[model samples]
Target: MQAILEEYLPNVMEIPDEFIEATQETIYMTVYTSLIAGVLGLFFGILLVVTRPGGILEQRVFFNILDQIVNIVRSIPFIILLALLVTVTRFIVGTSIGATAALVPLIVGVVPFYARQVEVALLEVDPGVVEAAEAMGTSPIGIIFRVYLLEGLPGIIRVSALSIINVISLTAMAGAVGAGGLGNLAVTRGYNRFQTDVTWVALIIILIVVFISQAISNWLIKKVSH
Candidate 1:
């Protein structure tokens, strides 16, 4: 049985060290990008919601400017965004290639996307709750943190999960530009080298990572909703 298994699945069984490194890089980029994007997105999203007309702190000018910027950024495709930000990436990370360098573009590309998602989530919160808080003399900042964010926790978690998954997908595009990761390994070692098994392995690993992420996110959503 062992001999048959080895013969049939030799490449899959003997995964290379570089593949492990690629996996680590993928995880690193995804996690850090998610953290950075999440924070920035949350800030922008709060501003977007709270600065709209009839919001707790209405400011049309600011909201319009922010809205336009987010729309412009989100419109750019990820692959082009990665190339377009080469200089910015080098300036920030002091290099234009590798996993660390990929983080800059990853954060930039995903920030607007996540921000929009977060804005939608926050907007879904019950308006009455916000009004009640306001009637009780809750400060704008206090109401934002308490009523909007806290009440919208479940929706926020859902969008956050979706954003992270999108980030994971974007990392693949980043890998195309010498950002070493599973995507790079699959492209260079699998497709380029004709190692179909390696490609399958990389894809399977990606699926596993996404599945775990989604499962955890779903569990948290359930717990929070309850």
Candidate 2:
């Protein structure tokens, strides 16, 4: 409501500073984790497709192992995985809690999902193209990178966009542990204090952020397609 905006504006006007800081953390968390996870996922996805059934890189043992790993990670709910990753996160980041520390869990947690997405997209590419590439003496790595990935790029972007949205959602949840962001502001200072106006404002801001991301992704994918 306009009233909510008016009521909370003064309190949160200075919030831009906190929002900026929190936004930086969110950006750091999203960018690094997404990059690491996307690259890892792309490799795993390529191998998954290439090694399965009659894939160019068919290898039963490797395919099964990768499939099981993907299933395992994808099966666990995000919050539960967040909890489980505590120690691994600490070992990786050298601490267990904070936006930066949270990136470890974020990467490990999302990689499999992204890999599966990449697998699906790559699989949609024409098998003939892959076969041609292979016949042309393209290495498995080169074929996977150049043929499958390039061909499926639009789909891959859509997948990445979906992952980015999820990352935003998960990071908001991470604020539960003082990760600090619009989510922390909403949950902590807003809900905990019965500041409904503040809660609404934070929620609106998060929605705006998500929408902005969605718009940018849509444009990028369209450009790639053309």
Candidate 3:
């Protein structure tokens, strides 16, 4: 195994530890950001659904404001968003470089995307189901939890899976800002150094992560789907 790796990736063999550390950083960023963003996205998504016109808890003004916020945030490019959020990231994390610091921008960048995914997922829930819940005197919150959430579980899982994949790519881009992940490894140690093997190795690892995330999402969606 060692001989094969040395033959194929001589540069990576020279800095196996760097590769390992980069992989760990990527995983840490992806997991924490996904979790944090997932919760916030879900909340905002449900809000969008509930406040839209003719919704159970409709408030056109509140809905418009929130909808605009999500849309505006989503419209900003990720790299530009990173620059824009530099001060906020520093205040929140007490620094602006490293895996932890990357979390702020990652969460901010992806929340709107994921929230929109959540909105799309929830919107798929049957209107008749919602009406039935309302007719049965269920509270808006109850309908949200039981009807919208429960009914949309499969689609939510699908979108969440896609969001995790998106987060993985974002973590790679975060490397451009000193977040120290596979993106850093590939760019700083591999591409910058002209180590084609190292770059290929990094790409392979990222693809593996994406595949695993996709597989898990598929399994969960299948399990939850009616």
* TM-score winner: 3
Would you estimate the TM-scores of all the predictions? 0.96, 0.89, 0.98
Tell me the spans in candidate 3 whose CA falls farther than 4 Å from its real position. none
Model 2 regions lying over 4 Å from their true place: 1-10
User: Clashes per prediction?
Assistant: 0, 0, 0
Tell me the tens digit of each residue's lDDT in model 3 across 1-226: 9999889879989998998999999999999999999999999999999999999999999999999999999999999999999999999999999999999999999999999999999999999999999999999989999999999999899999989999999999999669989998899978788999888899899999999999999988888875
Clashing pairs in 1: none
TM-score of 3: 0.98
Cα deviation of 129 in candidate 3 (Å)? 0.7
Cα shift from native, residue 211, model 2 (Å): 1.9
Encode model 2's per-residue lDDT on 1-226: one tens digit a residue: 7676556575566466776776677777777878888889888887898999899878999899989999999999877887898888888878887888877777777889988988898889998998899889999889877988899999989998898888778777877666666677778877888767667777776778789889999999999999
Q: In what order do the candidates fall by lDDT, top score first?
A: 3, 1, 2
lDDT of candidate model 1 versus the reference: 0.90
Candidate 3 lDDT score at position 7: 91
